[model samples]
Target: MNRLTVRAAIHVAAIFAIYLSVAMLIPAAVDLFYDNDDWQAFAFSAVLMGGLALAVALATQGRPPPVSTRFGFLLVNMLWMTLAVAGAVPFMISSLDLSLTDAVFESVSGITTTGSTVISGLDQAPPGILMWRSLLSFMGGLGVIALGLFLLPFLNIGGVSYFKIESSDIEDRPFERFQIFTLSLIGIYSTLVFTCALCYAMAGMNGFDAVNHAMSTVATGGFSTHDSSFGYYADNMAILWTGIVFMLIGGLPFSIMILFVLRGHVDALRDPQIRVYGGYCLVFSLVIAIYLTVANGTPFLQAVTHSAFNLISIITTSGFASDDYSLWGPFAVVCFFVATFLGGCSGSTTGGIKAYRFLILFELLANGLRRLIYPNTVTPVRYGDRTIGDDMQRAVILFIAAFLVLWAITAMLLGATGLDFITALSGALTSLTNVGPGLGPIIGPAGNFSSLPNAAKWICTAAMLLGRLEILAVLVIFTPAFWVR
Candidate 1:
């Protein structure tokens, strides 16, 4: 990369860090109100991070240049890493007494909306710290959406080029259009979060819990205020059902949501990805609910409610559980494991292989089967109204291949660190998919990641970054050819 590219990347990253530092004050204010000593830690961290950001910004300030595609990849990864470290400061300095590795692991998990936690006793943790964790997820969710909708399409990463919006002559100016779209999206996201919080409060939570959960729920980040997650409110059907509604909302495509809000139409309901995502959730929830009611002897009403909440949570990559579905049965266990990979719609806050890609894959397989039956027939795969091009198909297929390969490799590495087969495999898969809990005793729904080895924590942290960036964006930066130009 040229000096101009490097300078531009650093300049933009510094601005991001500086903006993130401002978020620290929210936690600091909370700490002060709660009379917790953690306020000083956040205040100190804010000053330190802000100083570093300002120094870089000042030193790199000059005639600004557009970020090249190569530099955009580098900047995206570097910005996340830098902000994660910056976000970890309070955890390391506070009474939480987390080691540096653990702190970074927690921070990365929060920022990636992975919902995995290395800390227990969350009910007793300081309000500021809890708020900070939720805020990290909220901010991270916004960044993920922006990257998916804007930068990823521009970079032609992950078959997202088809998502690029065309501009008419009246909207010919690129940056202005981007500004308007971003503002509109942010408004919609904020409104959803506010509405969710209000519903949670009405359903029976304290104001603090309601706000914190609203942030997590809207972000699909799933960092609950208690160890038992939504189970802490098991008897509160209203709260559980509220969570289900917002979690599904969080997983839906933001672009569609924005359009629905602006045009006052039902166009979003007709989206192919939305239809597939809803159908998947409905089918999986019913399967699990039936199993729970008939086999486990759970009451039918409770069975459906828990089943829907937990299924939606996992499918959306939200990671909240109203009960230990892991204990429902071996069949339920397998179903939840599979659901981890079938994430929500693209351009949403959720993670894993998105619904859009799966829709494409199914079309590809069906077309291939038809070709075998009738030789010399040309079968074109279609997604909604558009014909799938060869380039788009290849990109989607390559992404799935890379995702599975990386999951296997990460699992093996975790196993080498002495985790059991189940824990290793599930941990690797969950981390890579940005899903929170794994299966097995160690990292399962009932357990936390606090006991993992330092090496394992670092590996999981890297996996979170890799998954959040859609794998290829980070992997490409490491390739020799990426550096050659």
Candidate 2:
């Protein structure tokens, strides 16, 4: 990549930072309404972040240059890291007086949509802070969708190219096509958020709670205004069911949602990824609900509701908890832990080894078995209507391998820092999957990440970045070959 490419990337990233700073104003308005002194914190953060962004933009400004693929990878990663740190400014400056590590951890969690938090007293925290957390998740969700739909496909990351829309250059303009696609995504995303908010309101949440929960739900980010999370609304079935519906909507493929919106067809909903994701949720939910009812003697309806809600929450990587499923039984614990790795569909905001890769992996295994049974016959693996190329299969396999390796390493590192086995393992899995809750008391659904050491928090932060970037996007930058090019 040329220097101009790097410069242009920095310039565009700075522009993104400026746009991000604008979100601080929403929190500032909340502070003003609540008469909280935290308004100055947001105000100062906005100016500082915006000013730095402006400085960078001006210094790097000139004739635009083509952004090389290498630079695109670098830019995407850098923008996330930089914006994350910028997002932390308010947390550090506000009355909460969060330590630098805590601030960065909270900010990273929000921007990565990991939904983990360091703050403990959300019930009494300033409305501005609560709004900021939800806003970060909402914006982070948008960023992930854009990355999935546009950049990942272009970069061929993790076999995401499977979803790329074919264009006919002879008949259509590529730039206009992209523009229309992007606008459609934004429109659909906004509508979902609005509709979810209205549903939450009708479900008995006040305006603020409805809006905040809607943003978190649609993003699958799980930043509830209360420390108890969705548990705070446990008595309200409407709210819980509303969350379940919207969280599922958020977890499904955004491209499919776009198709559903424009073409007025359910064809996209029948995609292998969506079908697998839905089936997985249903099966897991039923298993857990049955275990809760039969084993624990819990009321059948309550058991099902709680089981389904928490199962969907984790599987979708939404992270909202109606109740701590950890107390259900050892069976429920195992189920929830396993669900952490089975995130929602690709092209959605949910994280972890996405359902698409799992489908690909299963197809590969089935084809391999068939090949062994009939050496003379050739079999081609197919996902949906398209044959899965060897290259894409390799990419998917490599991604899963890298993800597991990284998860193990992260767990070991956390363990070395003196965390218990359960805490370390669950913490590693949750961070890597962008799932919010771990299994143990310290960081479980009933708890937050506040007690972790600074080192562990930073480790989790890195894991969040690595996981959200799909491993290869961030790790490729560290390789000698990437630099040599």
Candidate 3:
């Protein structure tokens, strides 16, 4: 590792420590008034984070001005993992009597915006603890946007090479442009949160609950202040529709959004990703709605609303549900299983295979077919107006392959730990993707990860890290070549 890499890692560590300190204050104050057990957890977490952060900064003070690329990549990935470990401190130290594994699992889930929770009975849980959960979702959502437009572009990670393509040739994008776009993204993200919070409050939720749910909802994370998920207000169609709208907004590309903000236009309707993502929600909602009405005997209007909410929630990898589709007829099961891979647009907070990849994959397959029909023809895959080269397609393919391999491995390993097939499989996929709620009795949409076996919890932790790091970051660090001078 070079001096620069050491400095960057230390800088990230220090920032985390600062945030942890600020976050702990709330719980600490809550402990004073409410005498909640989570207060102890936050306090302990703060101390651990601060001490380690100080040590890292001090030790790396004399490091060089620049580090090797390998070390830089490794440092970034390792820093996030380390932060997750520290973030778990509060949970483990709390009154819940959580094991280290469960704490880490919850931490990873939150920081990754995966929304998976090992805690249960949120209604009775300390408000401080629940607020921390929402804070994680908020930070993680913004953190993802920052990483996408800034860090990921810098690292050329996860097919972020597209950003470079979009940038100017002279140092690529101007710093001024980047700043404007970033600020607009923050505004857009925050505005959605604000709007949703207002609607939720008007829809009978308390201010705190409304804000928390809004953040998680916009982030496409399913961390609920209530145990029943969004179903707690099943009678409120306005809130459900409000959630659907913001969830869609949350899943769109920030870069594309800044155009309207910067240029004084409202052309969100024209964006290809927006159209594709919208079309996806519509089609699936229609199919699932019809199936529910016909096969499950649900009322047509209720089926349409429920199906739309659930389809958007899952396809965007949001994980929220007003009704658990698992209890629906077989058609609902099939619909959900297929929807797992239809992630939101790139540069959005939602996680999964991502819609663009599937688009490119199908385009590539179609090109191959056209070429087969005309032996001497040359065909290329394109996304929007840009022609996608082989390197980009290869990167997406590798990403999908690596993602699935990790999911399968984690599921198999969890199954070996005594989880049934559906539970293990869904748990592995959902946890890895940072999507809350899995399948089956133990960790399904109606269940929480709180009751999972310790061994299973640890596996979920690893999967969450792997998924959030986009698979390659963690894997690259482990290769012997990555460690070389």
Candidate 4:
């Protein structure tokens, strides 16, 4: 709240804006190659944002004083808002002729990796726009990982303080320097994207579509080149499998990934969170596959493939649809909705309540039941080998409670905007979970969010931001107590 904190936040946002402005050129070049007039929009946005960002960055340049926790909250919120505004500029200026609300909604969805779309007919849209969307996901995915690794733990949101304690232990640090860890993350992220693109291309996607999808898949961002999503290649088992593989990878903990891949720490793969995540994916996929095979008469092999891909897609919060599972019947709808809340591992690109939180909740429930039968017995809840402290337990419980309350509130707000029960409920759930595409004929997998009222779009935009920031980080800033000190 102090001037120094505000100035520091501005300085960081300006530098980020400068980098984002430069990123605009890649899409500009793509549009130019395709002879699309939208290249002008990208060029204009890049110059305008770049020039202002440069000036701001220069004006704020100096060694900043040490800041407080308020500075972290302020910087994060301001930087994401700046990115949304900067990302929306091209949409407003381009041939798409989007209104401010729609542009911001789309930008929020993309940057939050929510994958919700207000713009349809993507098959014929400008190449630059498509590239820009994919780029937003790729960047947003990386940004969120960095946020999870450092900021959220420092803020002690949810149960992530445990993560910080684990990482900071004398023998447990991944790298002594921040720079080395960052470089490793970037290397691993880029390598996955590149390998995914290669697999997609080999599986028969054209280079552009392959690259776009690879970025989305690796990020679990789910911005597809076609409106049908992965259904565009529904018949291509290879491409579908490639997506399934990478989406799962995208959902695993990146810190564990770094140790397992770079440092050859085989035991990292045995992480309890990773095991719970895998278990949920496997169990849910099988249940869905069985339902499809029995109720829908889907062939067994085909059932397994589609069920695994689509379920993994939802669980990872990737939002890709290989088929209209909404039409698969009421049971499938219920299953998918449940999967929406079961996000991937913490520190991964995916979003939801997260697998570890559920693990902790279940463990706590079991322990509580045990206490009733044996009152004198003591049980220390454990995640991996570490005992869960009372503070961590309370944080996790509070986060889940807050998440559900917000979801219900968001659903009511959407319903007030004239959406039906299914649409409103799923819209709230999807936005809060960063799992795109609600249920029903409106915003279902077969449909888009383009028909929603402007107010609804804005509401969903707020929900996406809150969900992406793990609810508490954004909410804490609004409390009177946060500013009093």
Strongest candidate by TM-score: 4
How far off is residue 409 in model 4, in Å? 0.6
Error of 1 at 198 (Å): 0.5
Stretches > 4 Å off in candidate 3: 1-4, 29-44, 62-64, 165-181, 265-269
Candidate 1 residue 293 C-alpha distance from true site, Å: 0.5
* Residue 5's lDDT in candidate 4: 75
- State candidate 4's TM-score: 0.98
Per-residue alpha-carbon lDDT of candidate 1 for residues 317-384, written as tens digits (9 for 90 to 100):
99998888878899999999999998888789999898889988999999989889987999788888
Model 1 stretches astray by more than 4 angstroms? 165-176
lDDT on C-alpha atoms for all candidate structures: 0.88, 0.88, 0.76, 0.89
Who wins the lDDT comparison? 4
- Among residues 3 or more apart in sequence or in different chains, the pairs in candidate 2 whose N, CA or C atoms overlap within 3 Å are none
Ranking by lDDT: 4, 2, 1, 3
Taking all chains together, the TM-score of candidate 3 against the true structure is: 0.92
Would you give me the overall lDDT of model 1?
Answer: 0.88
Query: Taking the tens digit of each residue's C-alpha lDDT, what string does model 3 give over 342-461?
Result: 778777888777777777788888988898899798776887776887778777778888988888899899999999999999888887676777877788778888777899988888
TM-score of 2: 0.97
User: What TM-score fits each model?
Assistant: 0.97, 0.97, 0.92, 0.98
> Higher lDDT: candidate 1 or 4?
4
Report lDDT (Cα) of residue 329, candidate 4.
Answer: 83
> Per-residue lDDT of 1-485 in model 4, one digit per residue for the tens?
57777888899999999999999999999999999989999999999999999999999888785867888888889888889888888888988999999999988888888999999899999999999999999999998888887777777678455455433222466588878889999999999999999999999999999999999888889899999999999999999999999999999988778877878888777778888889989998999899999998999889989999999999999999999999888888899999999999888999999888988898899999999999999999877677888878888998999999999999999999999999999999999999998899999999999999999999999999999988888899899987775
